[model samples]
Target: MASTLHDVARLAGVSIKTVSNVINDYPHVRPATRERVEQAIAELGYTPNLTARSLRSGRTGAIALAVPELGLSYFAELAASVIEAAEEAGVVVLVEQTGGDRDRELELLRSPRLKMTDGLIFSPLGMGQDDVDRLDVPYPLVVLGERIFDGPADHVTMRNIEAARAATEFLLRTGRRRIAIVGAHEGEVIGSAGLRLRGYREALDAAGVPFDESIIGYTTLWHRSNGARCMRELLDRGAEFDAVFGLNDTLALGAMRVLQEAGLRVPGDVAVVGFDDLDEARYSIPSLTTIDPGREWIAATAVRTLLERIEHPDAEQPARLLLADFRIAERESAGAALDSASAALESAGAILHQGAGADA
Candidate 1:
């Protein structure tokens, strides 16, 4: 049998109203009274009826998370982190994919399905800065990614430009010059690829290296295939580069595969580095050197900020922007300069730039 609120109230020697207040975490309850109620709750194993409570409070015990596509490794990993964070907060997450289409993303913002959840955490790939006005909706919302900024909601994201700069600087410090960049989106200004590209340029500027547009590989998607395709094009054009920077891990991994197939020893022939320190980065044949973009922090902070907005809908506060920290992960894929073992490979006279399948 379910323990009733009345049973808990009777055991705690408090009125039913007092028990209600305690359960809701309402202010003004005395400390001793709260303690007594808590003890009674523990003994009676009383769990508040979330359905009834939500009906009265006009809130659902769930939040919605919308991302471009979970098929992409980064989004899939991010969604998992977000789900874990929501579970810790005693809330459920409803996930939706927008396929990275502009119209679909905009339609999601206006969808009635949002009413089923308390708030939304949205990551838009196709939307731009001009679409910020459309975020002025009725429900609480927190925006993720570099798509739109200075909007009417809390924004949580990583410092793409700064992190990318750090990644470039790391490669430069390892004595790798004439570095190539893969996964650049043409004409992207406020998007992740654009910002990361800017960072890479800044790093080169600071290092006194010339910004050669010829070494930039453009792609519409940051997928593995796109990375491989862009790298292949760069090679076909006879572009000379000592290292490569993949904007994301998938792209980096993809580029690495092509480089290996073309008889280039990773890090030995052309050092390779990528962003997003994904779980797979450590297990690649040669391992992958990448960036840790504070993914866990992004997930937890998004949930916390959304809940705050949901709790105080009438509070007049400007949108909040939170940036996640990033770090470089040193691994073998960046080449012999990154680790002594890779240097040993270099000493073995293994031709780094042979062709794929040489030693893969």
Candidate 2:
């Protein structure tokens, strides 16, 4: 009882081959004809027969996306963006969460469920650089996150060190000499915490400010609860800091809540900044000044890169590392001083471009 390709072609006044070309997203299809075919499809409620299409095209018409927890706003938003990009290309996305567990992540890499998809976009949290060999799967794979770099697959990630440094320097330019940090992992040197901490230190050194560890709030996770607890601990210990830099927006928002609970005014008594310019950042009281790490661009690029591999599996190009450019999203929490900093970056020719690193 379902409408077939022939029905769509008849309705659109086109040949079956033209309708097929439009359905397959072939670039050569004329725009007006494609529109007519699409209208016919929408009117008839036609559903694509993916199984038969796969048999003819030698592809599953689907891709898998694996991320560390969807509960985290960052990952959820990233997944949404990936799904949107895939839909634009007429492809389906299968999402999976790994809970950031090393064992689960390893098991997912070999999971038979992936056989139904043509390629994968993987973001691993618990896996480290030492476990890079596990990424050498037979499918077309594109890697995301700061955990494992120089892997066998193409890597797509943000410039953590540079972006974090820009965030710290923004606080310094606001005349906040004593800046506290939230969500730091003690003794870490490679993950997000380590790279962001390195950037913070680099900014302090560049500004001739001495690095003081007493005000640093270390936490095992970057959750809002951990941020609040970390802030409370700093207050209990009497750490004197004029500003707070939460590693992420959720942490910053949590710290801000505690700061107000303790009768401190934001940007009046203490300034605050965070990373991962989440949607909630804009709606928060006084709003949050944070780093926009080009998340949407990263998602789109990851999907496109994976499709390239899927379409040309035998291409001889080496694995590439694509890095996203970041910018400071000026808001009320960090004060008006950000205007000058943004101007400086613009004047210095800080153009947004996704640069490719040396092939690994």
Candidate 3:
């Protein structure tokens, strides 16, 4: 038979209530008493009956995580990080994929399945800012991604505009004046692609580089094939771009392969940079230069925030918009190129501002 709370309490020379207090991390417990309880728990291999605890606490002891396709490296890696964080919190995670379909994302928000879990950590790709009202559900919710903001829940996302600007500036700094962008969704106002594109334009304006529409590669998806296809399209149009910025690492890698196949040497004839510092970025042919968007922090913070909401449903805290910090990962892709890449980026900022003025 599995060890019981009585066994643990007896071994620790503490009452059962003391063991329960330690397990629940209840404040006011003496440090020495908590330590003894933990020691007894480890020695006896005591595991709490989560199902019973949930019955008493009126909580599920589990959380739901809904995202787009997990096949995408970014989402897959994020889900793994979330799972690890949930486990550390002594909670289970129920994962669901929405295929980035707008209807499905909306359905998930109102689904009865949400009641089975204590809270939800949602990353909606298809849903836009207009769908913010759907987030007004009964259960606790924590939103992730650039699609929706100012919703009825806490939000966690990367600094999309700033990070994209940094990536574009990195390419420009390498002496690449004519930079191309891939994996952009044209006329996108609230999505990740749109925001990142805006950031790219901002960086170029600040650097004094003229923003050329011909150099902007548009795509609906941020897939590898989309990257390659966009690069081919740019080449076919005879766009004079000496560098490429893929909004995501996958797109950058795809674009890099196509560029190489077209006889363009990476960082030699053309330099490439990507966002989202994925594991594959480090192993790419020339090693990709990308942005680290605080993935670990995002995952842990999302779980922590959700749990707090779940514990205190009546808490009057307003929805939060948390932005993750970003850093450029210098590698062979852009690092080995012109030593003046940083200076070039500084000049491109002026160019970006000029473009904005023309638009205004």
Write down the lDDT of every candidate, Cα atoms only: 0.88, 0.89, 0.87
Sorted by lDDT, highest first, which candidate order results? Answer: 2, 1, 3
Task: Report the number of backbone clashes for model 3.
Answer: 21
Q: lDDT tens digits, residues 1-360, model 2? A: 898899999999999889888987999988999999999999999887878788887789899999999999999999999999999998999999999999999999999999889999999998998999999998899999899888999998999998899889878876788999999998988888899999999999999999999999999888999999999999999999999999999999999999999999997888899999999999898799888888998999899899999989999888999888788887789855546665565445433233344224
lDDT of 1 by residue, 34-120 (tens): 999999999999998877777888999899999999998899999999999999999999999999999999999999988889999
Best by TM-score: 2
What is candidate 3's local distance difference test score?
0.87
What is the per-residue lDDT of model 3 for residues 1-360, given as tens digits with 9 covering 90 to 100? 788889999999999999999998899899999999999999989998867777887998899999898999999999999999999999999999999999999999889988779999999999888888999988899999988888888998888888888778767766789989999898897878988999999999999999999999999888999999999999998998888889899999999999999999997888888989999999999999888887888998899889999989998988887776667777778765466545455344323211111100
lDDT winner: 2
TM-score of 3: 0.83
**C-alpha TM-scores of all predictions:** 0.82, 0.84, 0.83
